[model samples]
Target: MSKSKFTTIGRKILMALSGFFLMFFLLQHLTINMLSVVSPDMFNDVSQFMGTNPVVQFALQPVLIFAVFFHFIMGIVLELQNRRARSIKYAYSKPGTNSSWISRNMIITGLVVLAFLGLHFYDFWVHEMTVKYGGGDMSGLINPNDLDSGYRYHEELVAKFVDPVRVIIYVISFVLLSLHLMHGFQSSFQSMGVSKGKNFIKKFGNVFAIAVPALFVFIAIYHHLQH
Candidate 1:
């Protein structure tokens, strides 16, 4: 009934909305990344299109970046609020052992994922932006001088992943990401008040959380093995 309670609820809903959007984005991203293994040419084509498309570059890209930041920032805010409220209300309460470890450590996993995002942006996004927008060449060719050499996207991906240390780091980060999603996916639904078929949703979330991050791990290892 308190205003702070209402605000917390509102923030949860907003966070849930942003989280849902981000989950969708992650799936889409994984699909695109998977193309590198299935067909490098196809991956390059899609990457080239995504890179050069004005609609994506000038419109959706900014929105995606905003959603990424907004989701994590709101998550941190809600976690702090929860800690404050718990201090006041559960001062003498015993810690619930029934809770899953992932649920208790969402903030930790979330922060790790946040750091991974920075590495990802630096590794791919920033470099690609420099090449596409700042390098004075719109052609996606590996060598702009020779058009027959093929696109640079797939080459860049494989080469960047060739370093074993980086691949290991990526795998570890994705494993933690899976744990984060396991708790987050169901919680997002609950936050949105979708209680019908809750059990089924939870099962699907478990599958999805594992499958997506596992595939990402596979992708990193697969590319690293190419060397």
Candidate 2:
């Protein structure tokens, strides 16, 4: 194959791989966060383990950070390419209106998600991992229930959720995320050239796109209600 063709294929492959990696990461993250809804104690236990465990702290944390960074960079590159390709301006165009709004505003949604991620890391990660485990700070700003006796990270999470403004932001962010995932889940497969059918795949993709995002929304709402 020609060099240009090879480059295009390689870029697409990287996008697809990074997308899949991030998707799996989201599922894992959701599972861990959802533990708070089930049992605060269990959630705190897991958070303590994740925060303090040498393997996870030293190995998995770096990998997770790299995955997020790669995903964001590739997304920006692909989006710029897409915008450049669509040179013609649309006049009252409603193409793909049947698709979810998230499908249409992925970059915007991604930015929202990224913003929330920063807030999340500061709220939980920095306090639990960096301060507690890394000996950075013990200012009692995070978990206030006696760190020496035992870490109570889960209580901090619940306290954060109780704030009306924070709850609203969390809900809004997750709603956008749901919309983003509605497109992202299936688009990842299509980007990888794994699907060929125009009819069956399209229908299946629509279902998956809606379902995954809805699941996330439900989880978020459930937590909000519990708080």
Local distance difference test scores for all models: 0.91, 0.72
Q: Which candidate number would show the highest TM-score if scored against the true structure?
A: 1
- lDDT for position 171 in model 1: 89
Q: Per-residue lDDT tens digits of candidate 1, residues 105-220? A: 99999999999999999999989888878897889898899989889989989998989989988988999999999999999999999999999999999999999999999999
Instruction: Put down candidate 2 lDDT per residue, 1-227, tens digits, no spaces.
Output: 46574476677777778777877777777677778777777777787676667798689889878888888887888789889998988888775767556677889999998898898788767666666647754433343455565555666776766666776777687777766766776777777877677566657656655665566556556666777
Q: Using lDDT, give the best candidate's number.
A: 1
* TM-score of every prediction relative to native: 0.93, 0.77
Error of 2 at 210 (Å): 5.5
What lDDT, from 0 to 1, does candidate 1 have?
A: 0.91
Error of 2 at 126 (Å): 2.9
